[model samples]
Target: MSMDVTFLGTGSAYPSPCRGASAVVFRTEGDCWLFDCGEGTQTQFMKSPLKAGRITKIFITHLHGDHMFGLPGFLCTVSLQCGSNPTKQCVDIYGPVGLRDFVQRSLDISHSQLVFQYRVHELLPSHDQCPEGEFKDFLSLRRENSVDPEDQGRTIYENLEEGSYELVADEQFTVKAFKLFHRVPSFGFVIEERGRPGKLNMEKIKELGIQPGPICGKLKLGATVILDNGQKVSPCDVLGDPIPGRKVCILGDCSGIVAVGGAKLCYDADILIHEATLDDSQMDKAIERGHSTPKMAAEFSNLCRAKKLILTHFSQRYKPQELVTDGDEDITVLKTQAQSCVLFGQDVTLAEDFMTINIPIKKNN
Candidate 1:
C-alpha cells in the first residue's frame, strides 16, 4: 500500500524556466490527489509520466495565484481528455472559501464546456463563514453542475476536536486537514494510511512443526489453533509486531508555526512537506510575505518530530546549487548548540520540479 508523491511544481510566487509554482501529486492504488495547481501546473505535468486526466482530486491551499492560478485551465484540459463518459472520470476539488466563485467565474467567462463533472468541497474553519453560493443553484445549472448529490460542490465545515479533522477516509487511508496561519485563510493536509496486522512468523510455525495448510490461514485470522498432538498455538505467539501506518503531512505556505493544535497535524509524520521560501538570513522578509525560512520549517519539523522534512516553495533568489548541490541533502534540521546558537543537519530534501518520492509501506511480511 505504498504511495508516491510527485512534485509537479516547487517554486514560490511565480513560475520560472527551471521551476514552476506549488503543485504536488499524491498517488495511491486507485486515487490521484493533486495539491495546489499553481501557474503552469499542466505544463509541468506534461513533463512527468502522470496524465493530467487521471487527477481525481485537487486541493488548493489558498486563493494565491501561485497556488491555484492554473485550476481553470488544468480542469478544462482534463475535461477534454476525460471524454463524454461522465461516470468514467470526474474531478473533485477541495479548498477554502471563494474558490467556488473563482473557478465558477473563470470557467464561465471563458465559456468552457466540459464532458465530465467536477466537484469542489470548500473547507470552512470555525471562524470563517461559507457564503450562500451556488449550492442552491445546482439544480438550475443543468449539466453545468453535478447531478449526483454526492459529487456536487459543497462546503465542509471544520470539525476538529484537537487540531485534527478528517477530509476523507476509507478502509485503506484517511486524509486530514488542519488550519495553517498565513496572510490569508490556509490549511494543511495529512495522509495517514491505516495500520495492518502483523505478519505471521513462518519460522516459528515450522519450529513447532506446523505444516503449511488451512491451519496457517486460521492463525492469520487470530484464531487459537490446536495441533494434532493437543498443542495450542495463539496467533500472538508467532506473529511479529503490528505495523503502524505511515503519515505524510503536506502544508501550505505559513508565516510561522501554528501554536494551537499544530503538532496534532504533523506529530510523528514520516514526511513533512513544508515550504522553505527563504533562508534564515531573510527571516524578516519571509515573515513579511507570510512565508517560511528553512530554519523556521526546521523548527516545525523538529517540534513535530517528523522523520523526514521535504522543503519546497523555494525563493527565486537562490540558484539550484545554493539551496542544495547535486547529491547533497537539502532539507536541513537545526538543533541548538546553546541558547541561541544552532547547527544544521542536511539529512532531508529540497524538492524540485518532477521529483518523485515513493513512500514504501513496511509490511509485516
Candidate 2:
C-alpha cells in the first residue's frame, strides 16, 4: 500500500508564472484528503492524474485569501463534473471559524449547489486571551468558536489526548491533528499507518499439534481455552505486541523555536511539511510577515527530528531559471542551504504545482 502527497498548488500570496497558491492532496486507499485550496486549484487538480472525485475531506490551514480563494471554484467545478452525487459519502470541511458562512455565501451568491453532502467543523481558541499576537488579524472570524483539545485528540472512540498523540480518523490507518503556529489559528496534521493487530504464530500453533478452526479464532480473540484433549493454550503464547505506525507531520507557517509550547505537538515525525516563504537572508522579513524562511523550515524539521523535510509555500518572487529576475542570490542561496542540510542541503526540494512526493517507510525485515 502507498500513501503519497500531490501538490495541487505551491505558490504563495499570489500566483506566479509557474506557481499558484498553496494546496496539497494526501492520497491513500484510493481516497484523497486535501490541504489548502488556492486559486486555480481545480485546474491544477485536472492537470494531475489523481481522481478528482476521490476527495473526501478538505482541510484549510487559515482563512488567508491565498489559501482559500480557489475553494468556491473547485467545489463548483467538481459538482459540474460529477453532477452532484459522485459518491454516497459526504465531503467534510475542517477549518477555522467562519468557514461555513464563507462557503455558504459563495454558494448562495453563485447559485451553486453541491450534489453531495457537506459539513464544517470549526476550530476555536481556549480563551479570550490571545495565545499569539500573530493571530490578531484573524480573531474576528475565529473568536466565535473554540475547539477543545480533548475533542481534537480523540481517535476512533478512544481518548488519546493523555499523550502528545490523538487519533483523527482510523480504519486501516489513523489521522491526527496538532495545532501549529500560523499567523492565524491553524492545525498541522499527522497521518499514520495503523499497526496491524498481532496474529497467532502459525508455526507455533502447528508445533503444538493443535487442530486449527474455531480454536484459532478463539486464540486470536485473546481467550485461553482447553481443547478437546484438555490442553490449555493462551493467546499471549502466540501474539506479539502492537507496533507503532509511520508518522508524517504537516505544519503551516511557524516560528522555528519551541516557545509558548507550540512546538511540542510536532515532535518526532517521520516527515515534516513546512512553509518556507522567504530565504535566510530575509529572516527579518520572515519575522515581520509571521512566516518562516527556508533555513527556519529546515531548523524546525531538525528540531522535530523529522526524518525528511518538504519545504513549501514559496514566495511569488522566486522564478525558475530564465523566467524572471525578481528572485535574487539570497533566495537561491537559502534554497541551497536547505538542500545541503540533508545531503548537500540539496535534500531540500522546491515544489511546483502538481508535483507528487511519496514518503518512504521502513520495510519490515
Candidate 3:
C-alpha cells in the first residue's frame, strides 16, 4: 500500500510568485481527498500529478475566502469533465454551517450547472453549548413568514448526529476530525492507516510441504487449514509480526494549541502539517491575527510528541534569505524557517508548493 501527500499551495491569505494559497492533497487507495481549496488551486493542480476528477471528498477548514474560493471553479471543472463520460462522479464536501450556502450562492450567481452529484455536510462542533438556540431562531423566523420549515432546505448530511469524531473508516484507513481554536469555526484532521497483516513466510510454507494452492488463501485469512496429510497449520506458523501503519495530522489555521481534543488528535503523529504564518519574532502578531508562528508550531509538535512537523502558510513579507528583525537583533531568514527543533527525535520541515511527501509503512522488527 502507498500513501502520499502533495502540497498544492502554502501561502496564507495572499498569493505570491513562489506560493499560491492553502491546499493539500492526500492520495491513497487510488482515491484523492483535499484539505483546503484556496484561490488558484485548480491551476496549481494542473502542475501536479493529481487530477480534479479523482477528488472524492473535500474538507474545508473554514469559510475564509482564501481557503475556499477555488472550490466553485474546481467543482465546475470536475462536472464538465465527467459530462463527457458515461459514469457520473460524486464529490462530497464537508465544512462548517455556511459552506452549503456559499457554494449554492456561487453556483447560482455564475449560472453554472453541474452534471455530477455533490453533497454538502455541515460539521457541527461536538461540544456545542447552545445548539437549541439556533434551531429555535430558525423556527421562529419560519413561523413569522408562514412557510413550512421543512420546505426551506433538506437536512442531507449532519456530521454531529452521525458522530463527527470518526469522519471516515474503512478496511484500509480511518480519518478523524477535531475542533481547533481559530477566529472562526475551524477543524483539524487526522488520517490513520490500519495496520497491515504480517507478511507470509513462503520458505517456511514450502518447508512444511504445503503446496501453493487455495488452502494458502485460508491461512492468509487467519484460518487454520488442514493439509492433505491431515496436518493442521496455523497462520502464525508462517507469518511475521504485523507492520504498523502511518498517522498524519493536518491542522487548519489555528491561533494556539487547543487543549480540548488537541493532544488526542495529534498524539504520536508521524507527520503533523501545521500553519506557521509568522516567525518566532512575530508571536504577538500571530496571536492577534489568529495564526501561529513557527516556534509555537514547533512547541505544539513537541507537546503532541509528533515525530515530524511540516510548517506552512507563510506570510508574504519574508522572502528567501531576507534579513528580518527578531526582537532587537537583526537576522537573515529564508522565505520559510526550515529549522529543526528536535524533541525526542522529532524534526521540522518547511512546506513548499508542489512538494510531495510519500509516507511509507514501517515493518515490525
Per-model TM-score versus the true fold:
0.81, 0.81, 0.83
User: Which has the higher lDDT value, candidate number 1 or candidate number 2?
Assistant: 1
lDDT of 3 by residue, 212-300 (tens): 87877788878898888988899999888888878999988988644446666678898999998877767898877778887778778
lDDT of 3 at 189: 84
lDDT (Cα, 0-100) at 303 in candidate 2 = 62
Q: Which ten residues in a row have the lowest lDDT in candidate 2?
A: 151-160
TM-score rank order: 3, 2, 1
Candidate 3 matches the true fold with a TM-score of: 0.83
Candidate 1 local lDDT, 183-229, one digit each (tens): 66678898888887688898999999999889988888778999999
Residue 97, model 1, lDDT? 66
Report the error of model 2 at residue 360, Å.
4.0
Q: Which residues of candidate 2, in runs, are more than 4 Å off?
A: 84-86, 126-167, 198-200, 211-214, 217-236, 240-243, 256-264, 321-332, 339-347
Model 1 gets an lDDT of 0.77
| lDDT of every model, 2 decimals | 0.77, 0.68, 0.75
Where model 1 places Cα greater than 4 Å from the true spot, the runs are 84-87, 126-149, 203-234, 322-346, 363-365
Residue pairs in candidate 1 whose N, alpha carbon or C atoms collide under 3 angstroms: none
Candidate 2, TM-score vs. the true structure?
0.81
Clash number for candidate 1: 0
